[model samples]
Target: MSQIKGSSADQPTNAPLGALHDIRVLDLTQALAGPFCTSLLGDQGAQIIKVEPARGDMIRYAGPFAKDAKTHDFGNVFQNANRNKRSLVLDLKSAEGQEVLLRLVAQADVLVENFSSGVMERLGLDYERLSAINPKLVYTSIRGFGDKVGGESPYGHWPAFDIVAQAMGGLMSITGKNENSNVRVGSGVGDTVPGLYAAFGTMAALLEAKSSGRGQYVDVAMVDAVLAVSEVVVNTYDATGVSPQPMGNELRGFAPFNTVAVKDGEVALGAPHNPQWSKLCTIMGREELITDPRFDSDLKRWNNKTEVYEIVEAWTSQYTRAELTEILGGKVPLGPVLNAEAIFADPHFAARQMLCEVENPRTGRPARITGPAVKLGRTPASIRHRAPLLGEHSREVLLEAGLSDAEINRLVEVGATTINEEQVLIKESAVR
Candidate 1:
């Protein structure tokens, strides 16, 4: 719908080899979960062709975009979620559009979507149809609940989001300060955790397809993903027959494994084991506590954690987080409660190459995004390209799909496809 100014991909011509170097993925999902899933694959060098609708991925408008952004087509959310992927715009509701997708699916190694359960069936592009065309196609889906391909759930048709997943997945039940003050996670783990699982499942399915010569469906439920990570809740309830409650900033069984007050903010410390607890007492000038009966072991200290935290806080409150970091940083598993500002300024992130500085292709201005977390020694993942403009790659992608220039023009002439002409120019000038 909008003027495009991007490319099929601004991919590095001689990029390093990646784990998924030979794979091609059709990214048909939007918002967080689906985009995030493909993003992981993209980082690992998968050829991710992000299939967006005529209006784009919806996130194209969800922006706190750069001040110098030349077009509204580039959104920051797109930068993080759809990086390393090319954007292709097609009106899937159109018969022509569905034909184009079927063409791509014929060669695509994988296809991922997050539409409500039956939307793919309605489009006649569901896995059954696509796999009939290409038996080696790894079909993947991310839903609020598990899809029928993965398993059965009564709530397949129910619409859900991050908050719903958190509420239903048992994460919020044990994530807050107390029984009545349950809070959602600071980030969208509900979407992202499921996305990560989908990525992993896709990889596993792809691996199996390599050996069996047939691709299978990989289904991921946001609720199940959340529960998978909340092992403490299930184990505690099963073993003790008692429900777990949020314990504020402290873990219940590990004394001093909690945030303590500091002069400017909170600093987390983990000296729960008796030896480290004794060392902490020495640092606090409370050496007598080494022999104290109430804190002689981890269990004893946990039993009296209230008193233990009070004593630790008395010492910590006198110092800033930085001061405490200098005093006890490497001696124990400790960290200051870092906000975004702190994280941005942290040198450790720089040293680890975690704060990646990527330029906005549309704006020709720079911004930072967190780099890939899963590092490999031989086949490292990277954030090599920025997000594409809406339907920025229509012509190039269509050409690659074996359509003639005339056919591409005909599609463009119809309401089925929208093309942006400027991305190729910008990409050649800026990147090439």
Candidate 2:
């Protein structure tokens, strides 16, 4: 285990009230799914005490690091999933560490974890045990397959990852150009989607617990979340008696609802409805196609989509993405398949504050990460703090858990926990 610094001392004290300002979450998750869930809560102004092993979250070492990096505490994946949280290092396998967690749970609004199915039970820190300590603690878990509490699956015990979830959940089947290509999504939707669902479930349970005076276990399955979001695949197969396959960039049963090759790059254009299709034809200088029998209605155009795509591409290929956008941006459902560079340079990112600039406390330098997506008029979510250093908040959090300074030092000395003398903020990298 490496020594790193952490604390909430450096954060803005005057941050606006958030929806979850009164909530306190004990985050016992790592990597993507679990961290993502707690991070969402943290962003919404919940105080997240991120409990980790002495060494910190494993994903902190997985990175394209910043220059002169001293500790494996700051990395791209870790930062993105861990913002607005405090770190508390404890060896959960230790009796002392377990005791500390129980104390924290007594006052916490929620506890969330993503360990393999039986790990919690093995550690004697399962929801049953935790809830005994704090009956109103909303315990949530994110697993590859559904957990027993949520409804057991045959593969519940098996460990799974993003690709595994996507493959099993029918997302890969309908993601690519054809049935042969089982394409994984470009983003971490397999994990993050489950995290989003888990967060929602936790909030719902917390809401109910407020009035009912009891908390329940909330389970989220990665495969289940993916399947829920891929309703098109399920509905298409159920209604048509045939599995859906990828149609490249085309939307099923819609004409001109595909990616077209432009002069410089590909642009997505979806003008399948009558008025929009007619307007698209006018823009393309193909007004005759609007009246042509084979390309008249959306169904007719879809039936002869090959010809329609060819004609659209012929017109689009003469214009650059910029040119096409200028002519038909707001008028049609259109966008260029923008790369990261284009996204960064886009005015929309600036106007909407989609890119947030956060300073690295360790380096005293700045980096940009994706900002909060949800925009509430009164209590919007925002990333107010950076990721914590490993074990950075051990003493502070332990003190809050009703431990004395001497007791905290004794736990640190005995290896039950770890804390640094000088708080070094472990600023993690963004997913660039």
Candidate 3:
């Protein structure tokens, strides 16, 4: 067997004093939400075993494949969400595979799955059964709608892509130019936010388990999570008895917090607070507007937002982003509407260590990827490894699970397990 070269055990350890370092996560998720949650855990130094189906996670094939790549590139999207974890492939439908999974569960601290509500129960790996093996395991389930609460709805069993959740959760209603033209946000916030909440819930449960000596189930619905983020829309309807319409590049309640044209490109400014508004006037060389009744108070300015924006834009359009940034540097919240290439070249991103480069052993090239969003000073998150090739650590992971070499080989022969070189090569060759 060819050794996998960059196991976490062999990496230079800056073991983050992260809160979840002691936790172990068994990730049986694919695509966006569930993997994103586990990625957060992995970033915080938790050990994550990403268990993929026999054919592998679908995201591996969802591309923008790498430049001139032959196979599914594991695209930037997958790489971004799946770093700092190990991969283990197993056929969950096989009896032997189920046995191996149960063995892994015996030692796991958490099990995260985003399959439809009852799938885990059908596979005999549901929270009730797994908790029997390890009573302290935190079992987290991410679904379109939670089984315990909303599973009987007609949409519950229907597969929900990100857009479906966005539309149903009120995000689409408030997203675009107007009421008739509801648009989805560019990113997968519907999936991503629920995953984030699920991760938070998992950690909270883990902390509780420490004292109670028992684990609990965490159920996060994508629609519920999206609704949580749509508080503004819900609150507006409740308070005014009016459904809010989409106002592109404009905030529903705030004035001068929207996009304004600069000399070259556009910048977004949020001088919502009184002091920030005053400071923004000073930055725009229009200090007199601070006392002008039409633009003085937040309420008055909100009523006349179009005129207020016109005044602000008249001043902003004359200056470059640098000039605007220098004027509003610490006075008001401001940022340029940067594109992808511009963001990659931006200094603030580099200074904050928001971007990092990891060497891809297969490509023998450095792959630049985004680092974890939150920065913890004491136990700062660090990238330990590039995203794994399919089944990259299968043998080593099963070995750690106490499986012998012959057992691993038997499973491999029976189409119950796979390794990186075999599976990824077929994928890579097909694309090439």
lDDT of 1 by residue, 120-151 (tens): 99988888999999999999999999799778
Tens digit per residue, CA lDDT, model 2, 201-256: 99999999989999999999999999999987889999999999987887788988
* Local accuracy of candidate 3 as per-residue lDDT tens digits, 139-213: 998888766843456667878878988998998998888788899999899889998999999989998998999
TM-score of every prediction relative to native: 0.93, 0.93, 0.92
Candidate 2 backbone collisions, by pair = 5-424
Q: How many residue pairs clash in each candidate?
A: 2, 1, 2
Candidate 2 wrong stretches, greater than 4 Å: 1-8, 422-432
In candidate 2, where is summed lDDT lowest over 10 consecutive residues? 1-10
Which residue pairs collide, candidate 3?
70-431, 70-432
125 in model 3: Cα distance from truth in Å?
1.5
Q: Kindly give the stretch of ten consecutive residues in candidate 3 with the minimal lDDT sum.
A: 1-10
Of the two candidates 2 and 3, the one with more favorable TM-score, higher being better, is 2
Error of 1 at 346 (Å): 1.1
What lDDT would candidate 1 get against the real structure? 0.86
TM-score of 2: 0.93
